[model samples]
Target: MSERTGWDRRLRVRADGKGLVGHAGVVLLRRCADQVGLTGALAAVLPVGVGHGWRERAAVVVQLAVAIALGAVNLSEAEQLALHHRNLFGPAASDSTTRRTLAALDESALTRMAKARRTVRRHVWSLLHLRPGGFPWLSVAGRRLKGWIVVDMDATVITAASKKERAAATF
Candidate 1:
């Protein structure tokens, strides 16, 4: 199969087979260290809930990197897509393992991970690059368009089973 080219390269996306986690993560992390203060930033990043021995916990990073690589980008999809690609990462994980890992990364854990990594932060801000110019594609009105971005958020409802938990704020 020849490498993807032309418009297919632009809109429809696919992985390069190079693992997105280790190498891509190193690149991204370095960019982050440059823009934001490294120690302070890393330290400031809260834990994604309790770390689980780095074995089962490895899923956190793998899932995240792959999801970002594929542009699914949301936590739920991140969890789902991560499961879908587990074999690509090596060592086939049973559907149950995937479910358990994802369940462990439940809302609270995801919030902590997002908080600790400042996952929502811009790469330019995190990497220290001044945000890119000329509307991602460069057209007449593209200049005025929002460039290089993805907006994400999460919400949960605590049923009557838990009276201690309550909606903090209203939109």
Candidate 2:
């Protein structure tokens, strides 16, 4: 397998479906982070050696994020990214290392991290603006708003089983 920076191995699409890696789509997310400069921007804001020899704290954070996107609830579960797909994703930081990295983040570091994310977001939006459609528009109340994006941060709750006698079943 050929090695690539950011990605451990080059990925190819196959129609026959001879070999498939489960959860391989996470690679795309990692690639997106690398392409959009999220990885580098985060690394710039976060301190080096925070993971104690992991080298790239940004990668650890990104990996953890990817794992969470894949339904990982904790840091130990994030290790599955490397454990199962070592070829697609290179070495991953241990939970302890990840804990250290997170612990190293002070208020100032978090502020810097937020700033870095905003910077990368702006850069990505600028690139989108250069696209053929000239960025996407949001419509509200039949009015098209240019250069606007709406994000809905709503909370959702799901109950598996309730002990209450009068509880209704949720599908």
Candidate 3:
């Protein structure tokens, strides 16, 4: 067998005006936001600070939600969007900015946000033709069970190859 382990270009390069191209999926999210009035609803419910721009509050909240949906465990992941799709998502908030924004939420703001989210959810469900169904039931062993749900949270097993804090042989 020949030993060749490097990537080879298959397509000719064409000079494009833009250098960045990724996270095109965010376009779908933007369209969905427009269709469901997500940003508008959020703007109506969220509090705007003195420095807030016309759409800053909605933009930040929507970006955070999108980041979470895209599997961001922390606010720093917002930087990925900033790097790749800044034009699509607008200016991405820094990790500290995101943390401070969320931390500033008060009880009344939380309640309003909840209401807005519910409203937006209903609108989107209707637009998507989603039917809210009751809890799934199960029939097993000649018995019928209603309102049954199951969750399995399997734990990870770690083996101690070296000694450290709280390190055990097996956990």
Candidate 1, overall lDDT? Answer: 0.45
The number of clashing residue pairs in model 2 is 0
Model 2: what TM-score?
Answer: 0.69
* Candidate 3 RMSD to the real structure: 12.4
Instruction: Rank the models by lDDT, top first.
Output: 2, 3, 1
**lDDT against the true structure, each candidate:** 0.45, 0.77, 0.64
**Backbone clashes, each candidate:** 3, 0, 0
Q: What digit string (tens of lDDT, one per residue) describes model 2 on residues 1-171? A: 323533433466578875457775676778888889999999888877634455488988888888889888888888766566655666777888788888988999999989999999999988977899765578879989976765434434656777799997774
User: In angstroms, what RMSD does candidate 2 have relative to the true structure?
Assistant: 7.5
Q: TM-score: which is higher, 2 or 3? A: 2
Write down the TM-score of every candidate. Answer: 0.34, 0.69, 0.58
> Where does the lowest 10-residue lDDT sum fall in candidate 3?
2-11
Runs off by more than 4 Å, candidate 3: 1-20, 52-55, 128-171
For model 3, residues 23-129, the per-residue Cα lDDT tens digits are 54565576567557878887887766675543366677778777777777778886576545565544677777777778878899889888988998877556545
